[model samples]
Target: MVVVGGGQAGLAAGYHLRRQGLDFAVLDADPAPGGSWQHMWDSLHLFSPPEHSSLPGRLMPVQPGETYPDAGHVVDYLSDYEKRYDLPVQHGTRVDAVRRDGDSLVVEADTGTWRARAVISATGRWSRPFLPAVPGRSVFTGRQLHTVNYRCPADFADQRVIVVGGGNSGAQIAADLALDGNVDVTWVTQRPPRFLADDIDGRALFDVANARRRALEDGRSDTGGVASLGDIVAVPPVRAARDAGLLYAKPMFARLTADGVRWVDGSQSGADAVIWCTGFRPALAHLVPLNLRGPRGHIPTDGTRALSEPRLHLLGYGDWTGPASATLIGVGRPARDAAREIAQLR
Candidate 1:
């Protein structure tokens, strides 16, 4: 078997495959062990603790007195994890396509080809950031950047900036920008933001989401009192921003203008730049040869195994691949299941 991706999701799948003693290799396109995580903004940190954000078979080692691991910390952990497990990871190998060849599948990559009995595509979503099509977006005179390219708030000092999206990225970036009044920042959200209190953070929400998923899977009529964990968790920076009255979020404007954005009520705000944190779509172009993708570029799956192509499973894209499977903590379950099923065939 072959796993395409070396990030948390792929590592989780590798962990499970190793436990099953399956002959498999994880092919990562990255030059180093850390996948997309190495490319995230420097200040990004996990909302959950190290204990809740670990891959299967190992706990992410936490620094003394640290609650959350930053992006660099995670990269180090993943690097150490690959070494610790002795996982067969072929670095710098970019998979171009996965096509059917007789009873086996052919994994065509930049390095070489591998004919495997099954394939698991865990390319993840970070590589494909989603940017909404807004009118006059192209005509805006100001600089525009997606969250994928945003590094730090220090770059936009004294500039009028519009931070778009209601997720943690927007909130965190807004907080960073507002911390020292470095930038004049305006936050925009499609709806009112629901901030989870500090006491009830992402760890609790992850637990609830998993429990809810299990209940539904078992055909039990239990909701577990949580519909979604997509809201913002009140991390220290975000909390401070809220306390300082800098976390104000307004509804999204109707359209973009040449110099600014216009609201539905004829209101407009001039801005020097826009930071879009609107999230991402799954990166699954490599699986086009399998013809397993559906709406939203997702491969419909039964758990982690693709419904249309049973031999072609997808991991860590999102809930469509597996319940809460996009998160560092949530991916282990689905990865384990997918590996086990593939092992059974061997």
Candidate 2:
């Protein structure tokens, strides 16, 4: 079998696939594992803290007093996971498509093609950042970009900005800028997202996680139509954002004019930058032969019974277990379960 996307979920899945003796291969687009942890902007750290953010069979090194860690720290841990488990993941191999061809599943990438009896799709929603549609997106005169494109806050140290989205990333960016940035930034939201306590351990998804967990457990997919991170549960993003006094109205944007963003109130806000923390979408378009998924764009895989394809499974799906499913703390749970399922296929 082949696992696509080398992020956290993919790495965990690859580790388990090896344990199951399933003759599987992990296909990741990056030069090494570390997943999205490698892509996050600097100064970004895990809200789940070190204790909760650890991977399967791998313990994250202790950080001084800090509960959460930064992207660099996470990358280091992923490297260690590979070394400890000796996971055979093909680095820098991007999977362009996954389709079934009679007897086996064929994975196509610019580098090469891989055939397998089953395929595990781990490309998560966060792999791609979603920017909200605005009226004058092209009119913005200053630098306008998404959180995905952000590498660090140094650029915003002395500028005026507008941040969109009510997710954790938005909140964190606002807090960092307000405190450390050398500039003033305004954060806007289309809707208020919920946040979980920094204690539960994982990434985003708040109260809504409970609801999602119930849905998956019941084998009833649809995740209530894949709402925002806050819709899932109230997590650190909400708590931390409120604590920072940098919150704002939802759905208050009008459009982007050459000057800046036009607010719903007919006021103009000049922004040197705009950040979208709007969350992510699943990358399952390549899984052509799989007749899976519920009403929401999520695959229908419960704790077990990988029924998406004859030999297919999906891992690292957000909020599969409610708040914890997609978090670093929660990924191992599904990885363990999926490992057993893969064994059954053998």
Candidate 3:
């Protein structure tokens, strides 16, 4: 077996695969095992709490009442976890193609070719940057950046900036720029995302877990703030932004103009820079025969199984409802389950 890409999801699968005693090697395009986590924007962190970010059998550094861990902590921990596990990982081995040649699965990479009976795809969903096609994008005079490329506001100080998207990134970045006391930030979002709270301090994690279960059992949607807050450490930053008077809600964007942008409300503004926090795209470009992908270009699998092909599985990347679909915490169950499945195959 061969595992591809070494992000959290990939590494989770590798960890379980290790315990399964499978003869497998993990390959990643990055120089190390931490793949996409190593490439995220600097000002980000796991929205989930630190304890939730742990892999199976490993605990992330946390003390009671310490607050949620940030991006640096998550990155540093994943880097260290890879070292302690000593996973047989080949860095800089960008998998170019994966196909089934008769009974054997073939993997072609920058390093060389390898064959296995099964393959685990753990490359993650955010591999491809998604940018919506807005009018005048090509004609923008100042600068345009995706949240994927945005690190800091160093260059946009004192400039008229219009940020697009209503995710946590867009909301928070606009608020940050506004708080910077130099840049004039205008936030234009098509729709505000529904935020959810996952934890609260001084409460039992199980209490919070029960509330979530009730919400799920009651068929609650992701569009509203959770009515029940148990294990969550704090309220969502979006709600906090409202409490702080940092948000200005508006209609969707119609398109962009050479001078700036025009919103659905027939309002026009001069934007020096446009930052798109519009979210990510899942690209399984290297998959053989492109087994199954949904209409939106995500791998459409049966969720937890991870096997898009009989002996071929895809990890990390988002799929239908199962343990391995989206959140960092969602990876372990599916990764380990998939590992067990792959072990049986071997």
TM-score against native, each model: 0.96, 0.84, 0.84
Error of 1 at 174 (Å): 1.3
TM-score for candidate 1, residues paired by index: 0.96
Using lDDT as the measure, what is the rank order of every candidate, best first? 1, 2, 3
**Alpha-carbon deviation at 98 in model 1, angstroms:** 0.8
Candidate 1 stretches greater than 4 Å from native: 222-230
* Better candidate number, 2 or 3, judged by lDDT: 2
lDDT of 2: 0.70
RMSD of each: 1.6, 4.0, 4.2
In model 1, what lDDT does residue 84 have?
A: 96
Candidate 2, residue 165: the lDDT equals 71
Per-residue error for 208 in candidate 1, Å, reads: 0.4
How well is each residue in 1-346 modelled by candidate 2, as lDDT tens digits? 7888777887888788887877878888888668877888877777555766787877788777666677888898888887788777888888888777888889998799998877777877766666667778777888877787877658877788777777667777766666564768787776655654444444333334556766766899747533533332324444554676755545658898886777778888777778776777777777645657666676666553345565777777765422354666667777777777768765
Q: Over the stretch 233-329, how does candidate 3's per-residue lDDT look in tens digits?
A: 3335544555666656566667778878777778887888888878876657888464665566755565444335677676666434343234566
Write one digit per residue (lDDT tens) for candidate 1, span 1-346: 9999999899999999888888899999998988888988867788888998888888989866678888888899999999999999999999999999989999999999999999989999888899999888998999999998888888898899999999888899888888868799999999998787678776887878878888988899878434454478888889999998989899999999999999989988999999999999888889888887687677778888888878888899877778788888889989989988998886
> Each model's C-alpha lDDT?
0.87, 0.70, 0.69
- The top-ranked prediction according to lDDT is 1
